[model samples]
Target chain A: MRSLSVPSSPVRDLLALTSRPEVISFAGGLPAPELFDLDGLRAAADRALTRRTLQYAPTEGDADLREQVAARLTARGLPTRPDELLITTGSQQALTLVVTALLEPGSVVAVEEPTYLAALQCFHLAGARVVAVPGDERGIDPVALAEVVERDRPELLYLVPTFANPTGRTLDAERRAEVLRVAERSGLRVLEDDPYSELRYRGDAVPALAASSDLVLHLGTFSKIGAPGLRVGWLRAPEELMPALVVTKQAADLHTSAFDQAVVADYLRESDLDAHVRRLCATYRERRDALVGALAAVLPEGAVRTDPDGGMFVWVRLPGEVDAAVVLRRALERDVAFVPGASFYAGEPDRATMRLSFTTGAPEVIREGVRRLGEVL
Target chain B: MRSLSVPSSPVRDLLALTSRPEVISFAGGLPAPELFDLDGLRAAADRALTRRTLQYAPTEGDADLREQVAARLTARGLPTRPDELLITTGSQQALTLVVTALLEPGSVVAVEEPTYLAALQCFHLAGARVVAVPGDERGIDPVALAEVVERDRPELLYLVPTFANPTGRTLDAERRAEVLRVAERSGLRVLEDDPYSELRYRGDAVPALAASSDLVLHLGTFSKIGAPGLRVGWLRAPEELMPALVVTKQAADLHTSAFDQAVVADYLRESDLDAHVRRLCATYRERRDALVGALAAVLPEGAVRTDPDGGMFVWVRLPGEVDAAVVLRRALERDVAFVPGASFYAGEPDRATMRLSFTTGAPEVIREGVRRLGEVL
Candidate 1:
């Protein structure tokens, strides 16, 4: 118990490899720097600071940020009230709060075979027994999830249904409905982590699982859209969960940055988020295709790649018994980096798998990075 | 267990009461808004946003902020190394991380009998058995702490030695030394929470426990000096505890806001924090005296108050069997608000005690606010 850790996040380890100026990193799920609303955010920061907004905020968050977050979700077809939301440091903190409030030590938590690695870290730290439910290119398989619920009786099912981290897979509408039905019937809590839905380039936007299920705890973040630097996010949970979540959030950091929240609120109020997202979608879309096409053209014939419709990553299953660490080591020498997919699994992982993010680099850089990775392989 | 809260922080509850425009609130230990280095911070924000400082910072914090924090401590006689520190979302999170890393369920923690109420909540949520060591205006009794250490075999002792919350007490040099000696001898870790140390008004500053003891974990925050709304804080822990704390912080919020930290670093680099603090002290000192004098003139006989040298609140012990809740109810009727001291205790609390902050109001407002409370009494 003394050597306690929330498991070493191997994805962050992957990010460390990108320190050199020559490194074209596909390892981190960073947004394109060029797409950031820097000028707008600068003005927003100026507005926030001048209002003497440097005092402590309410534990829930600044009211305007809450309303802005609520409005954004409402625009995305999820009816949300300001009272129903709790602003978090990021969705990362919202995840931490939800788990701390809802899960006891050694509680059973079910997750997709490959899910957000950071969420896995949070669960592991809380001493939750995480059972992986098998998933495919289109997100977690509903039948497998049902089986896990039947066998393990998990208290919670954590999902990243729309453009999930690592996989970049969006759960189809039918699967979303079935999963929600299973959760509602079983009285199991479902966490709908939706950080990437709005960054879509091609596919039709699927309504969030939270929209359909009362059991769903929806997490949304400005990290991907506004700026990760501000560290702002929100959780839309059932009223029942609010008390515990609030208490947990209060202890975690007292509150997220009121100054940052005010800046975000100002930015959200004044700027065109949809237009900005569309631009991000366009930029990330080209980079996504470049990596997929490059991996297809460069890697061996037996290598399988999931061509994601949108979002940050392309999941690759390299041919044969290839070790990710070895490939990563070789890739680093050539100034190219991608996270080993083994890092995403709850237990035993496929050593052959890798996650390549396209959001951090240009299309040509993506092609070059992939070409370098192919040479290393 | 389901209604999990760190503890019910009445200070936050007090802030909620301040929403009414007519209420003269002395319930929260908030800073003077007018004293904030707003112009400097505005420039810092401009500089921060200009440098593309809107990216995920290193888990510990931005390098420059850590160095600045370290340098500030070095000036205060604590030889802090940049590597020894982990920047937190505020010292609140520093506490959360330290407890998460060091404590297990049912772990014994010895705290000052009316220590920070929110610390109790964090300990409670972590399932720690918080044993109280009796304290007075001179701060926690070191002899009582040693006795608790002997009988309870507690793993940690949490103290706010200088300008402690609720009591507005400063532990003397001899007491600080004795406490450190006992803690080191007992192999009990000491958490020296020092948010208000820099807000000195009347007395000479006390050197921190961490400066004298290797067993100490020091927490410092910019909230009291720089800005609470920014929510930046740091932990100076022994290298042995760094790993677990780092992991806990990573799982907690990934890291404190880089954008905020960068702004703070820039502000620290550019401005004189000492000058700002001196101004704060000058402002608060006058208000503090006003409240103390007003209470003397207005309160019923037998009411006792601590005339603090520094920090925010003045703890008042109301006459006889006066229920604090009742006094607060009546105080609200007169549009005067303060925290009933009953909210600060771990078990059954002192109903006759109250805490009033002089930091928020001007001298006239403080005098008027105290008069209204006197009328209510």
Candidate 2:
């Protein structure tokens, strides 16, 4: 009875390893502060300082904000209704609500190998066992996912189709269509977490898998583009699923902060969120390019790194003889940090792999951090 | 699978009954708009609109806000550490995190006969069966609670010991001690939810039940006194429970909005929150008096209402022949609304009971709403 019913994060115990202030972290998926639109926030705050903005808002969200989100989705070729969207504390709570409503104890869920640790945590807490499907640099392997679906008949499959965490891989359009087709055939509900879609550093915009499949639950967030401090995010699901999601949300946090929602709504209504997103893409691309170039110049010949089209991270594979955990410790002594690849795995940990975030620090800092890592190696 | 997993809210389902624009709603547990210090909010926004305020913050919350919460608790004689407190989206999220950690399938929980509906919803969603203990007008009856505890030995007992929802009842100091003793003897963790503690319309302040027992988890909110739009709340628990709550919160919403936390911390630091509380007390007291007076003049001779010292609601018992739900429907038809008693109870609802909220509307609105309700009756 003393033990919690929810499973505790094993990563928390290992948190002590990276807690020192001197540790220059690439471990966390934190957005760059310089990329945040501070001037826009100030302007938004000025608008929200009105008496009406301080009042309680509709639980669904402010209608104008929902419409803004809908418009953004529409621009991306995914038509959405205000009623189909539920604003959450963050995309994390969106997952929490979806999992709470759709999952039961011992329910089977399929996740990509080296998935987002936080999503894995949510699924584990909901009493679901995660089945890892083999994925490659091109994102989830459709054949492997189909095999798992045939074998386990999982209730749901979760994926970050664009700019995946810990891997920094995006599914090609053909793979996206195949994954959607397989899910539809197997009757699997797909949770498409797309927090990084707008942060694309290169390439043409890809249509969401949700646009191709009615069963897909699409998640979006303000964390990557704007500020994580606001904790504003949303989920778009089928109409049949909206009521349950709302109820689960009510049980979770009643609703996201109304004041934050109002500020965001005002910002979206009056400002150029797209232009802000363009700035994020431009700055992050430079940082990404710098990190990639620095790794090429500094790392040993056999070391390999992911070439991400967009988003914050660069997943690197070190020499098999050198464990990432060991490298992380040595790097931290040189005042640098990265997430060990093991933190992202559902079962089998890849000791030689690690995730480095390139978006949080400046290009010069990234170069210096990589040079230090090279020295440690 | 869809039907079994999603537990619908009966209250929210019935919200359509009072959805008309003309309705003077006593159904919502919202604070009055006039009571909001717009001037203070404007000042706070101005101060918090800087570049630093728009950046990401620690998941636990900003240090200054945590210090302010600790100070407020210390002044109340409840010793709290800044680390022990995790700022939540609201006290609602505080309860959600507690339930997510503590409850599993078939777990037994105890509640007052007519408890806060949201708590019941949360517990139910967490896969717990709530057993109601008979409570008198003064709050959870110590004798009945002890008997239920002896028989059931539930995992936790949730109660609003001060100015409780649906009942507007406060537990006396002696009863609070008795509850603590009973809980300790029975090994039942007590969740003391006290959102309305600062809204005392009359009498001196009573120490929270958490002050009497180390096992008690205290939930406090800024919604009643300051602004619900900010959605800031806190929980103080024993050291052992802090880790589990924090971990659960990490999965639920990452953390409450950091911007809101900074604004609240800034507001509290620069101004006397006590002064604002005094204003709320004065405004709400006038509204309460108006409702009480109107009920006396308009209600039937057999009608009875609790005389609450503080808080938003006044629980009323109409003639046994008159069903509150039916009367609520009639009242809504006449452009007035309230929560019917049936929504509050987990087992058999008292058909004669209803809850009238006095804090959201003005004195004139309250008077008119009560008159309309009386006319319908």
Candidate 3:
């Protein structure tokens, strides 16, 4: 039999490297284990593993979790109903299901240049033609997005509107409204991903375009806020899209774990998630400042890094003469690891750029890691 | 911009009905909740929710859980390595991954005449051309399978070799050998779904065909033996297919929950799973006998039922005039439920057939439920 072929995800391979004890890794966007509310989670799990929780749950997910998620959305000003939300294993599954259910083979889907690597992979796996629209530090370039959508005539535009992966960029409220108008005018669906908006340390919350636009599909996850090991996330789209997504989810996996959902729901009710998230923001802000602060002292010349308002990552563009992958190899020699930015782009890649996650390490570790990275350079 | 469309899975809707307390549900292939080793699982969960378990796990799975699974496989006469196993959200996800990695749009996949409805939905989602091969009481008809493979030249053959779904049919030693020989000679890849093999009540345990065949891709789950709510399952396949499968899984959801994996791994280590399964087998055996004994008295003159060697279901062909769907509708009025058989077929459906699961009820409940079903008939 002939072997089927698919490219290995560069980020996934980098995740494998983090297990090496010597490596101070910024390769994976993992949450800090020390910060997890384990005591709260244990109590939640204890209360949730009853007879009702042991049975198979609905395809959409546990009703209590869905309602809780909807309430969270409402708390953020994007009011939603339990029935309108589809619970997922994580936001990744929500994105994958949304893409799979909507896009067909050869269907064009426009994405921001150097976007979340996994989203690009999901779109590619759907057999969609991925068109890249250039973006600045703020977020997707609206002019570029409008032009690309008009020219490519893509079915959907995938965007990480708030605290985007790899870049840690957040679009302003005015730009979000403009993008929504553009999407409506261009007849393009917008996937508004907002996993890290809640982790803000130095910025006002920008309401999601999904709150105002019918064309936007909103995605949120508890991985950053609550516990990643629970593997809980949700998607809020228009009522019409739920059936197709639910059907696809049924085919993918009957449903996410019921007991896990119950545990998360229990935690949401009994624990101080708001305070816990605030604590996460406070800790991550220090780590982010330390890493960004070190970059200036470390880099030689012609290298620039984004100063994110809040999130897990800081994106750096290396000097033109140096390749990020090559630098990564050298950095590993000094036991520092970061993901090269080549894999995130839909079209021509920024081979001289890299993404460093500040989530796994503390301020001191971050400083030392950046110093080691500087030594390699 | 435009609304996408996808058909709802029939069984998914059917599963929704089982939540009503008044309904005696034989519709869902659920394990007996009372049989769930809750005390053991609690101890395991307590042991597992450490700092490491709260962090992200390898995409392949927990090394310890994989080793445990491999050891279990060895006990079944199919010695596997930890590297060969990939943990999934459930066995459903395993099937989805196998189909996603192996089959493309319009790829041919051979299935049994009446197979697991979810598998059919998965094949359809992959845009596959499914061809059904006829089967007898024991298992798939070898001659028919050979003809279909020659004609359809399918990329894969999905089988439930031990305790097949819907039919509750097991391939006898001779038939299994012949089927394996045919598969080898024809170069047909086999997906052996053996979720219910461990639940045997009154028969000799047949060594899996996967133990001998290189073409076989084996799937297993903890849902039946340990708990369904945990949503832990795994697959063992040739190394060649692992990369593509892993890539798809990465894009789907980073990985299964690390805490769930650790919990199951701890349970495997600390609990007497062998004794627990034996207890399950003994309990289910009585239920099976009650249901089978009642079915003979309940069904009409021409109706017939297959006595499963092991598994949750007893497949019954009702009287010619009675439609299974109609019977289901009527039975629900009397607070009893069984899945109609039509959706299980790839081609022409058996409208007069139905499947009753014996796993959810005890002997008394099974007898009473069956007698109530008889009244409706």
DockQ each candidate and list the results.
0.65, 0.61, 0.64
Candidate 1 ranges beyond 4 A from true positions: A4-7, B4-8
> Which has the better TM-score: candidate 1, or candidate 2?
1
TM-score of 3: 0.98
TM-score of chain B of each: 0.97, 0.96, 0.98
Which residue pairs in model 1 clash with each other? Answer: B6-B121, B7-B121
lDDT of 1 by residue, A244-291 (tens): 788889999999998999999999999888888888888888888888
lDDT of each: 0.87, 0.84, 0.88
Q: Which residue runs of candidate 3 sit more than 4 Å off their true CA positions?
A: A1-3, B1-4
- What CA RMSD would candidate 1 show? 1.5
TM-score between candidate 2 and the true structure: 0.97
Q: How does chain B of model 3 score on TM-score?
A: 0.98
lDDT of 2 by residue, B37-111 (tens): 888877877787554556655556678889999999988788888988888888999998888878787888999
Winner on lDDT (1 vs 2): 1
After TM-score superposition, the amount by which residue A94's alpha carbon in candidate 3 deviates from its true location, in angstroms, is 0.9
- For candidate 1, write residues B1-377 as lDDT tens digits: 25544345666777888879899998877888888888888888888884356777678889999999999999999999999999999999999999999998999889897878889889988889999898887788989988999999999999989988989999999898889889888889999999999988886778888999889999999999989999999999998788788888888888888899999999999988889888888888899889888889987888899998889988999889999989899989999999889877866688999988889899898888888887888
Q: Docking quality tier of candidate 1?
A: medium
Could you give the candidate ranking by lDDT, starting with the highest? 3, 1, 2
